[model samples]
Target: MTGAKELDRFLAELTTERRLSPHTVSAYRRDVGTLLEFCAREDIESLDQLAVHHVRRFAAESHFRGLSPRSIARRLSAVRTFLAALVEQGRLTANVAVHVQAPKPSRRLPATLDADQVASLLEIKADDDLAIRDRAMLELFYSCGLRLAELIGVNVADVDAADRTVRVTGKGAKSRVVPVGRLALEAISRWLRVRATLVKGDEQAMFISRRGKRLAPRTVQARLNHWARVQGSPTRVHPHMLRHSFATHILESSGDLRAVQEMLGHSSLSTTQIYTHLDFQHLAHSYDEAHPRARRSRRRRQKTK
Candidate 1:
């Protein structure tokens, strides 16, 4: 089958039959679409004409263009899955990209702010209606360890203040209830008091924009960036950073990986274990500062000698 037509068919199936989210379908389209472009550049006419060498070349080209290993792996997966679908349909003889391997992604620890840094970041006073909403948004993000999409998807009724918990729809449209911190509950209550002012029409969203509609992710990001600069934070603060901070802080204090995984809505314990490395980093730093035999002491001794 021709690259363009075949890919279009597969993406339509992904959207219609599989019922994948628009974001996921778009990702699959991009990855496979890039491979089709690669095939065209190399003068390979159709999906059947493509070879394993072409797939490897595409990966090499992706690396040359500065794509990360993880990104390349995803792209490779997209290509492999697409070919598998074609094989089932009898358009291709076999999945040529099946044996192709993308480089293993390295485990990089997520950046997290300390408790003091978080306190400083969340020090925004509720000056106006918008400010009140922003404060609540920031609080809920840190309090719940929510993803950007999850935070925006929340509705007013989703928060149960009396119960001190919030029901959020996370990835895959899966819903979970997470506990709300005292500060988040307080901030949310303050926002609710002033929320009626912003709602000119019937908007059921938890967070509203100046137009009285649901707040966009970009606006949330822009506001958070402004606050991070104003607070004199060394790192560029983003929503995920708040989540990482929440997870790391909770793990450090509670030392409960399973509980954290549940709170994070992570499907696997392995995904949650990355925080253990971040925890170890703090321990290593503390040891260097406190232990006499640490490299910190060695540096002091060398300087004195």
Candidate 2:
């Protein structure tokens, strides 16, 4: 089969067999399209004809085309998975993409709001329906360390007020129960009371728009930025920042990586361990500013002389 036809079959398997998210599948489609393009250019017509050198050249070409290291790595990963599937199906003798490597991408630390900053951001007044709804959304985000998709997917039935926990469906459709903070529960309670005033036709979403439908992701983002500005925050706020802040704050206090991992619905401990680095970075910053022997403090003192 042609590479294009093979890609279609692979994508179908990703959707049906693997049950990957639409967003994830779409990314695979885009990434594989680049590979097909490379094949057409090289006159390589079949998956079995692909060689390691071709895959390496594909990565080099992608980099030269101005793709970042992360993007190139993701594309290479997609190619590897696609070719491996063909190998499993006996359509190819081997997965040629397996031996290729992309440039290593530098990992940047996730930006987070400090405790005081988070407090200021969440201190929004509930003067109106929208304000009440936004306040609840913000509280629930920071309270549970939920991903944006998980937060948006929440329904009224998912929250257990008596248990003080929320049932969230996270990545790969995995479900987990996480504790809700008392303050977040209070905010949600207040929002639910006013929710009836705005809800239209039997919407089940925990957070709804003014028209009573499930809140769109863009709308949620816009509302968060609005609250940030209204709260006089210096840094622009986003949903993920709240999640990072929640993880950081919890780790700072408890130092329980496993607990934070469960709450954040991360499938791997390493994914959750990034917060440990954030905690250490915070401590390092404080030390640099306060310690008499700190290099930065010492430099400042010497400059004063």
Candidate 3:
């Protein structure tokens, strides 16, 4: 089969059988597509002709082109998945990417907004419809700690105003019920009233675009950047930052790791444990500033005495 045909088949299987999200499917397509390009350059046409060396070289080239280790690892994982699927389907005998390993991605701490920063962003009022919609989205993002895809995928029926809980479909098509802050619920209620004025069709989407259609992830990102600037944020705020803030703030206040894991919908406690490091960092900074034994604090206190 041709490379494109194979990719199409694999993607169809991903959607129908694996039930993977579109974002994940696209990432696999791009990674496997890059492998095909490398095959063409190396004069290899068939899946049986692929070798572990070629896969390693592709990883090397990606690194040479300045791709991050995490990105390279993700690309390798995609190629590995594709090759494994082909083997399972009797299309190939050996997996080319099985032996090719990517570098371990460095674990960087998540960035979060302080409570004051969040309050300022959410407190700003919206006069226009677009701004009103954006305000609702912003509130929901922090209120529920939703992933970008989950937030955009929310429908009118997913929200229960009386319960103050929203049903969000997350990664792997898993649904979870999460609480919504009163402010976010109020903002959503306001947007629902003005929503009909903008929507053209019988769209069930909770957040509609200016064209009266479902909102796009890119549009949400662009709006977030705009609002970040307008709100005088030091850096351009993104959706995941809001999620990080939600996790960090909640963990700091409650210190209940299990509760936070449920709220964030993490399948593993280890996955949710990253926020504990963030919480500790916050505590260390506070201690440094408030404690007299710290170098800076000791110097200041001695000078004052």
Candidate 4:
């Protein structure tokens, strides 16, 4: 088979055999397309003609073009997956891209809104029906620490008003129960009443658009951006920022790292450990202000004595 035909067959296998989502498959296609274009430019016509050196040069060029380490690493991963597919099909003797090492991604701290900022953003009121729904959506996102997918997936039955807990289906189809605060519960109640009046049909989703369908993630993100601007937040806010704020605030108050992990539905404890760094920073600030030994005046008097 020709190289172009082989690539098509491999991608078909990815869809039929691997059962990857359409979004994931598209990303892989784009990543591999870059390599294919480079191969054509260099007069390499077959998968077997590709070499580790070619991949390394491509990565170097990407880095020079100001791609972040994470982006480069993901691109390399996509390439490796494609090459491995070729090896499995007996088209290549070995997967050369496997030997190429990706640069370590920088560990940037997750962005979170402070409690005051969260309150201010959530306080923006609209008398209209869709406006009421937006308030409830933002409240649930911050109050329950929900991912964008999880938040939109919420059904009316998923909310347990008596228990004040929401049951969410998280990554990998796993379900967990998260508690809702009083403020969020009130907002939800108000939205439900208003939604019933606006929406004629009984859609199961707790949040709905003006047309009475479930809210899309993009719409939720756009709404948050609008409210963030109105509230005067320094940075643009998204759903995940509210999630990060939820985890950060919980850890700051309770100092229970394990509990936060369970609440956030993080499969690994290591994923939850980053919040501890935020907690430590909070403690350090408190110590500086409250501890005598940390006081500059106390240190100066001891030095004089």
- The top-ranked prediction according to TM-score is 1
Where is the poorest 10-residue window by lDDT in model 2? Answer: 1-10
Q: Which 10-residue span in candidate 4 carries the lowest summed lDDT? A: 1-10
lDDT of 4 by residue, 3-93 (tens): 6777687789889999999998888888787778778877887878788898898888778888888888888898888888888878888
Comparing 2 and 3 on lDDT, the stronger one = 2
Please give, for residues 1-305, the per-residue lDDT of candidate 2 as tens digits: 24888889999999999999999999999999999999889988776788889999999999998999989999999989988898899889988888788998877889999999999999999899999998999999999998888999999999999999999998898999999999999999999998888888878999998888998899989999999999999998888999999999999999999999988888899999888899999888888888877977689889999
Q: Candidate 1, residues 94-144: lDDT per residue as tens digits?
A: 899999888777888888899999999899967877778999999999999
> Would you list the rank order by TM-score, best first?
1, 2, 4, 3
Tens digit of per-residue lDDT, candidate 3, span 158-233: 9999999999998889999999999999999999999978888789999998889999999999999988888889
Q: So what's the TM-score on candidate 3?
A: 0.68
RMSD of candidates 1 onward, in order: 6.7, 6.8, 8.5, 6.8
- Please list the residue runs of candidate 2 whose C-alpha ends up more than 4 Å from where it truly belongs after superposition: 1-68, 71-98, 295-305
TM-score of 1: 0.71
lDDT of each: 0.91, 0.91, 0.90, 0.87
What alpha-carbon RMSD in Å does predicted model 3 have with respect to the real structure? 8.5
Candidate 4 wrong stretches, greater than 4 Å: 1-97, 288-305
Who is ahead in TM-score, 2 or 3? 2
